[model samples]
Target: MGIRVGTRDDAEAIAEVHIASWRVGYAHVLPESVLYADDFEPRRRAIWSEWRFAPTQRVAVSVDDTDRVVGFAAYGPERERARGTTGRGELYAFYFHPDVWGNGAAAGLIDHVGERLRAEGFDEAVLWVLDDNPRARAFYERHGWHPTGIAADFDVHCELSVPEVEYHSPLTVEGRP
Candidate 1:
């Protein structure tokens, strides 16, 4: 697989990966209605299209040998100023096609984002994950991320409210971990 910066043409594939990952990753954590929504694809496509052109966000995509986008990661300046941290970047989103879950695509995309964030002058990086997603939590932990004891309610399509926790990692000059 190859990792590269995302472009406008990757919007649709990124949206698809987002939806597919959520459907599988949050199957038991989110409400059935939210996960099974018939309009999910179109709505996600629209949102991703906007994200693709957003000036503040940096996005990257992981593609297979055939050049099909299999996963994506997005990051930028932290949006929640209430976190009380300055010079912090936030990983706005990260997802992979369910089929590639066990592969290294997610890790590679994450490393790319971390490097990009470090190059942007961010001192640290933070990301939120569903508190109940043990798999994701473990993944982050393995990458040297730790929860900051912060918790909040996350609305999934405004249809379900789930608990989320924030994970943080300091970015050094080398951007390792």
Candidate 2:
């Protein structure tokens, strides 16, 4: 088991894992067409291409011995209400293939992103999760994340504006979890 910084070259493997994650972990939540379609690769490629030029962003891709990404976390900058109070960086996405769940992959991903944010001048961090995903919500809570009750229009999967809950952590890496 190994993990390292991701690059543009990793887009293919990352896309496969991302789409697999959506299919297995979010099948009940995300729309069938979006999560199960053949367009996943193209959309993923577009996202990776855009991220390649975004400086200050971080991507920690967990891999097996074969360098296949099983999980990843990508985030940078504080925006919206996140920048209003905490004045810290915000998490754009934190996801892992459900096959790798409970295998220390998530903790490593969080630590990588959190450390990067701390070094990049963010004193706090926040992430949004679906309100009904109890497993993920519990995992965040275990890692010292708490809800800010700042719901948003996270209609990425659903036809309507799905209720998304915000989770925040003010402590730095040095702080207890």
Task: Give the winner by lDDT.
Answer: 1
Error of 2 at 122 (Å): 1.3
Model 1 C-alpha lDDT per residue in residues 12-95, reported as the tens digit of each score: 899999889989999988777887788777788998988555999888899999999999888898876436666689998988
Query: For residue 161, what is the lDDT in candidate 2?
Result: 54
lDDT string, candidate 2, 50-148, tens digits: 763377677778887787788887778766762366466777777787788889878867777777788777778888888878888998898889998
Q: Give the clashing residue pairs of candidate 1, or none.
A: none
Q: For this target, which candidate reaches the highest TM-score against the unseen true structure?
A: 1
User: What would the TM-score be for candidate 2 when compared with the true structure?
Assistant: 0.86
TM-score for each model: 0.94, 0.86
